[model samples]
Target chain A: MTPQLEILITVVIVSSACAALGVFLILRKMAMMTDAISHTILLGIVIAFFITKSLTSPFLIIGAACMGVFTVYLTEMLKRTRLMAEDSAIGIVFPFLFSIAIILITKYAGNTHLDVDSVLLGELVFVPFDRLVVFGRDIGAKSLYVMGTILLINMLFIAVFYKELKLATFDAALASVLGFSPVFIHYALMGLVSITAVGAFESVGSILVIAFMIGPPVTAYMLTDQLKKMLILSILIGIVNAIVGYWISAILDVSIAGSIATIIGITYLFAFIFAPKRGILAMIHLRRVQQIEYAVKSLLFHLYNHEGTDIEKEESNRHSIYKHLHWDKRFLERVLKKAARRDYLSVNKEYLKLTPEGRKYAIKSYEVL
Target chain B: MMFLESLLRDYTLQIVALGSVILGAVSGILGSFAVLRKQSLLGDAVSHAALPGIAFVFLLTGVKKTEMLLLGALISGLIGAFIIISIDRYTRIKFDSALGLILSSFFGLGLVLLTYIQKRPNANQAGLETFIFGQASTLLKRDVYIMIALGGIILLVVGLFWKELKLFCFDCEFGKSIGFSDTKINLILSSITVLAIIIGLQSVGVILMSALLISPGVAARQWTDKLSCMVILASVFGMVSGVVGTLISSSVAHMPTGPVIVMVISVIMFFSLLFATKRGILWRYIKTRRDSRDINECKILINLYESALNHEEVRHAHKTTMLKPIKSLHYLRDKGYIRRDYLNTWVITDLGMEKARNSIDKNRGERV
Candidate 1:
């Protein structure tokens, strides 16, 4: 396979893996925690590297993954302290840890190919060079195998504990009462998120890692409400993002990871503005339609209330009804026109009267509301 | 003394340190309000969002003017915030999803612009990456002045609107009930908070600047419940961290000032979390432990007293086997409230009986 194929596969595997766990993370309201984990794990990788003195050592992955879990642990500890809010706890802890890692790199490891720049703003251009050779055969990029395994592990964990995870994620109290430990499930899922971050950020950078992790799942969430469908949609979106981002970067000669993140943003914006049922335009249209319907009903109700009353002339006059309802005159007129068009009301001289159909509609709306 | 003399003498150190101090203090004062309103993560989002603005300015003007770049940053940050608000208000999508999405996507666009600039043949783009992982040693005198001016303006705005801001932060519904426009006040406070985050973006980098905006307030809140005191304390903590971080990083060979300052403020926050008097983890733990032990001893004492009432004597000996052992009974014994009559029996004294009556009444939750 060409280097281009290798890079594409790496991004696809990483995106899907991150998105797989992201569904659970966003559901648990831990989006920012993943942000914190992505940064703080740098410190873990740095310290682990200092000990092992090798970038390819599995210990580095273990150490970084542990640090990701440690980030969650510290944030939770600070939150349990109750001195600050949850986001403050995250905002405080990760930077502190990441800064120390950064300080170590700049001060001591400056000459060791371990600068802050490359770790944070990852470079996927170098993926082809780091080939994994088995028995003198150049198989593929190392990231391909690593991220692929992580993706498989994510799917397996989610699949094996599907029942427990679903119960725990939606209703932890019930899960615990039913002899399944939600806290145990919570930490295990976090551990998977950590391992995935360890693998993914090496290619996509940390910030874009957040995009890949959260963007696809959230976009999927916009389209569907079912968990099974959300997971499948998330992976599908991740694959599309990887390919489109790759094409943009290739055409423009820009950062591939960055272009992917930008693409993710554009896709989400498109969905947010034009999704079938939940799109912004659709919602605005729905509100407008509902408003006109509501206005017609209220007009009918108002006319029905004033029929045969001593103040009917003042209260039920078509031109003066806006003052009583506190609605705009133009809006009232529009509603009146719509009502007359629909045969819900008619004008007798200058006063408004509800027809039989309008009376029935008004009573039904009152009962339904 | 030597460091202070050098700090006074070294022009670059003086400028960077001064800039750090102002950025730190301003962020702290505004951060108290941010944390109070639970908008602590807004700093992270806004700072990250400011990147594209900075990049866009550099791309257009081909100059790295701090003022122009910051103007771009301010514009884009506002746009990003507007997008976040619209997405949150209009869609079923969660606020955090919107926040994470906009920040990362904007930063990504900024990265694209930056790489596009890097590919261009321009020496003027030398220190542009410093905004990502800020290099304080590179701060110019003019940059420090800009920091001071912006910091001063923010402080003034915070002061002029302190009353309305306090009400909005604490009780927006009550403020609205009494006829203050909650939306307008919220907009003003949030804009200034964004300004604070923007000013620090040049010195602390995009990712870690949120720490500067959030840490001091969190630390100050541990010590004081009053907003005024919390703001004051936060500024002091911010300034101290800023100055000390500058000093430490200057002494080191290749230390980046941003992360070091983040480390210092974090240390301060950790200390506050652990040791502050009123709400510190240590004090809260001690109070809980003492109260729990009190409840345990009171239960045993009440048991012994109630049993004594069934008998003729006010102080009756009871066998130890029937009751679970209370470890703090030694506390009662030391106070001469209860005594061990034999190896297996215990008796309540008159003092113990009176204490048990009080404990029962207290546990009953009301009294005459």
Candidate 2:
């Protein structure tokens, strides 16, 4: 396979895995912990590199995963204390670990390939060059293999523990009574997150890793309610972002990771504006249209209900009803035309009168309101 | 002893130490409010968001004056925070997404700008990277003085608004019911949060500044239940972490002060998490164990009383072989729950028998 195919495959695997894990994190409100893990893994990577003196060492992944877990552990430990909130705990721990890694890089390994920039930002472009060869045959990019394994593991874990995860995510007390250990599930999910972070760090870098983990899942969440549907939607969104983001970057000659992240942001924006049932625009438009329809119906209903009154008794001065109702003339005219078309009202010469159907519809609306 | 004397003697080190303490105290006092409001991530977001502002200022002015740059940073950070709040209020997007959105976009924008600035013929842009990871060594007397003064102003504001802050955080609806504008309170609280982030950004850098703000609040939280006490303790924790971190970094060869400071704060947080009274892990463990042990003892006594009741002669139950049970039973007997006879058997004492019956009655009550 070509390098381009390798890169695409890597992006798909990594993005899907991140998105799958992102769903739970976003639901549990632990997205920032994923961000924290991404940064803290730097310390693990640096330490591993210092020991093995090779970036390709398997120890790097192991070390990074340990640090990622350490981040979660520290955050949990801090949270148990009354002195700090969960966000503060995450805020406090990861930066310190990241700083230590940076210090080590600048002091001892400054001349080496290990540096703060590469560790924090990563080289997504170089991901395809780092091939994993077996028996003199190029198997594919090492990142693809690593991320693929991580993705497979995540999928399996999610499948096996779907019920427990759902129960814990939605209501921990319920899960506890059902003989499901929420804490165990939580730690297991976090562990999967760590491994995924380590795998994705090589291909996407730490900064964009958050976007991968948070964006697609959040977008999917806005569009669906069912956990199964959400997971599926998130994976689909992730794969779309990877492919579209990659092509966009290739066309624009910009950073692939940045492009992917920007694409994710754009996708979220689109979802925000257009997603059915929950989109902001849809809600606003629905509310406006409902209000307009209500106003029109209410005016006609009030007039029809008070037929014997002075305003309704004088059918020759029907335009005067607009004044009593305090509605705009233009709106009244438009509503009158719509009502006439629907046979809700009849206009004769210079007067307006409601038909039997219009009267019924207006009364129904008023009653409902 | 030598290190202490040397630390006191060096004026620059003393300034750095004093500056860090002041910064830490400020962050701690404000952080108590931030943590209470559950806006802890706001500090992190603002700090990251400030990057674009700093980069923008540098790009526009072509200068590296800390004050001017920070002013721009403050404005942009506030804007970012405002955007976050507005997005959360208006959209279905959750708090985390809003935070992520502001954080990534602002930081990404900053990076793009920094990269652009680097390609220009400007030497001042060289130190922009330092903001990503702070350089505490570059702090001078002016920086120290600014930190102290700003920190003092923040502390004063916190002191004056302590009651209002507490009321707003504990119950905003109540605060509003009592003629307080929740919006105004929120604005004030968020402004303070943004101010804290901006002030700390210069010394702690973007990545670690949030830690400086949060860690002390966390550590202090573990030690106290009262808001006032938590704030004071958090300030003290922050100050100590700052001072110790600065000292460690200065003393150690090639140590980055920001990370060192963060590490110190983390250590303090860890200690408080494990060792604080009432809610600490250790305390909770001990309390749980003690309660379980008491319950177990009660169970054993009840068992002994139940077995004793089955005897033909309850008064002469001392010779019963069934009385001598587990080792814990013997210990319970020594505690006056049971009387041991010469035949290596046991009899339930009147007090023990009564207590055991009451314990059994309580268990039955629970079932009912």
Candidate 3:
């Protein structure tokens, strides 16, 4: 396979794994925790590297996962003290841990292949250079194999505990009462997050890791209500993001991860403005429709209440109605025109009259109010 | 002694040190307000958002001047802040989710711009990347001057609006009910925070700038309950971390100044968590232990008094049955709450009985 395909596969795999686990994170309002984990896991990898003396050692994943959980634990601990709120606790703990890792890298690993730069500003192009081997046969990019396995682990975890995870995420108190431990599931999920973060760290960089983890799930969430659909849609979004992001980076001659992050942001912006039900555009339309309907009802009711009175004849005319309602000429013309179009009222040269159907509607609206 | 003398003699080091200290103090002060308002991560979003502005200004003007770059940074940071406010106000997305979205998206744009600039010949984009991870060593005397001026302005604004900010942080609705213009105060506070972050961008960089902003407040919070004291203490902590981090990084080979400063602040936070006077873990632990011991002492004294009243002969010795009660008896005896009679009978003294009754009454009162 071409290195481009390999890089694309690696990107897809990383994106899927992050999005899959990210569903739970976003649902649990733990999205920012992923940001915190993505960063603090750097410290775990650094510590594990010091202990194992090898970059590819499984210990790195374990160490990073442990650090991820540790980050959550510390954040929670600080929060439990009642002194620190959620954001402050996370803001304080992860940066401190991340800086320690960065300092350690600059101090001890400056001459090594692993440096702070690689960790922060990830290199996807270099990913294809490191190939995985099995029994002396070349397989594919090392990142591909690593991320593939992590993806499988994520899938297996999500599948095996799908019901429990859903129950716990939506209602932890009930889940715990029913024998599903929310705390355990939360940690297990965070552990998986750490592993995914570690796997994607070198390939995508930390910020992009966050962008992928949160962007797809959140975007998918905006477009759907069903969990199953959200999961599938988020995975699809990830795949599309990976491909489009890769091409964009290739064309622009820029950072692939940065391109992907930008694409994710663009996707979210699209959903934000254009999602059918909850989208900003739809919301604006809904409000405007309701406003116009309300104005029509008020106009009909006014005409219905004063029909057959001598003063009503003058008050119900277009000009007098405009003055009575104190509406602008254009607005008055529009609402009156709408009322006529809807057959709720008839407009003669100088007088307006409510139809039988319009009388019923006016009485109904007045009674409801 | 040598390090101190050299620090004074070397103009470059002195400038860097001074710059860091001012950066620390300003960020620390504003951070306290941000943390209190639960906008701590806003610092993160704003800093990352500044990168695009920096890149944009550099591209448009083709200059790497610190003042111009910082001004660009301030604009983008405020823009990011505005986006966060809009997303939160107009959508179902929570504040945290909105913050993360703006942070990542803006940062991505900045990275693209940065990479694009890197490819251009003669762009002199050598120092641009440092804003991501920060390179304090490259800070020049002029950059220090900019930091000093900005820092002074931020501190002055915070001081001038101290009461208004305090009301704003603790109770926005109350401020509004009293006819204070919440929007004006919010704008001033946010602008000051942006300026503070822009100053720190050169030394601490975007990645860890949030750390410098928040850790000082976190540390100072452990020591005080009052807002004024917390802000002052946070500033002091921030200055200490900045100075210490710079000194250590300079002394040690290959140590990056920003992270080292973060580590120093973290250490201070760690110590404060354990040992701060009011809210420290040690103080709480000690209080609980002492309270339990006093309760135990009271229990044993009450038990001994009951035994004394029940005994037919005052000389008859009543041996304690339980291990805990025996230990408590020994303590009571030491404090003259109990006496050993001729036959080795433990007798409750007048003082002991009085103490026992007080303890019993207190326990009963608490339960009710």
Model with the higher lDDT, candidate 1 or 2 = 1
lDDT per residue for candidate 2 within A112-156, as digits (tens), equals 776676555556778878888999998778888888889899999
TM-score for candidate 2, please give it. Answer: 0.79
Where is model 3 more than 4 Å wrong at Cα? A285-369, B176-187, B298-319, B322-324, B331-368
Candidate order by TM-score, decreasing, is 1, 3, 2
Tell me the number of clashing residue pairs for each predicted model: 0, 5, 1
**Which residue segments of model 2 deviate by more than 4 Å?**
A1-17, A73-89, A99-111, A125-192, A223-263, A273-277, A287-369, B176-184, B296-368
Candidate 3 accuracy as lDDT? 0.87
| Deviation in Å, model 2, residue B136 alpha carbon | 1.1
Expressed as tens digits, the lDDT of each residue in A31-122 for candidate 1 is 88888988888999999999999888999999999999999998998887677788888888888899899988878787787767766678
Per-residue alpha-carbon lDDT of candidate 3 for residues A1-369, written as tens digits (9 for 90 to 100): 999899999999999999888888888888788889988888999999999889888898899989999999999998988777899999989899998898888889777677777776689999989988899999888989889999999999999999999999999999999998999999999889988998899999887888888889888988899999999999999889989999999999998988888898889889888999878898899988888899999888778778887789778877768788777888888888788888888888898888988898899888999
lDDT of 2 by residue, B42-68 (tens): 888888888878988998999998888
Candidate 2's DockQ is 0.29
Highest-TM-score candidate: 1
Q: Is the docking of candidate 2 incorrect, acceptable, medium or high quality?
A: acceptable
Best by DockQ: 1
Interface RMSD of 3: 1.3
Task: Provide TM-scores for the models.
Answer: 0.95, 0.79, 0.88
Compose the digit string of candidate 1's lDDT tens values, residues B137-255. Answer: 87889988888888888999999999999998889889999999876776677678778877787788888888998999999999998999999999999999999899888977788
Q: After superposition, how far is residue B207 of candidate 1 from its true place, in Å?
A: 1.4
Q: RMSD in angstroms, candidate 2?
A: 5.8
Pairwise DockQ winner, candidates 2 and 3: 3
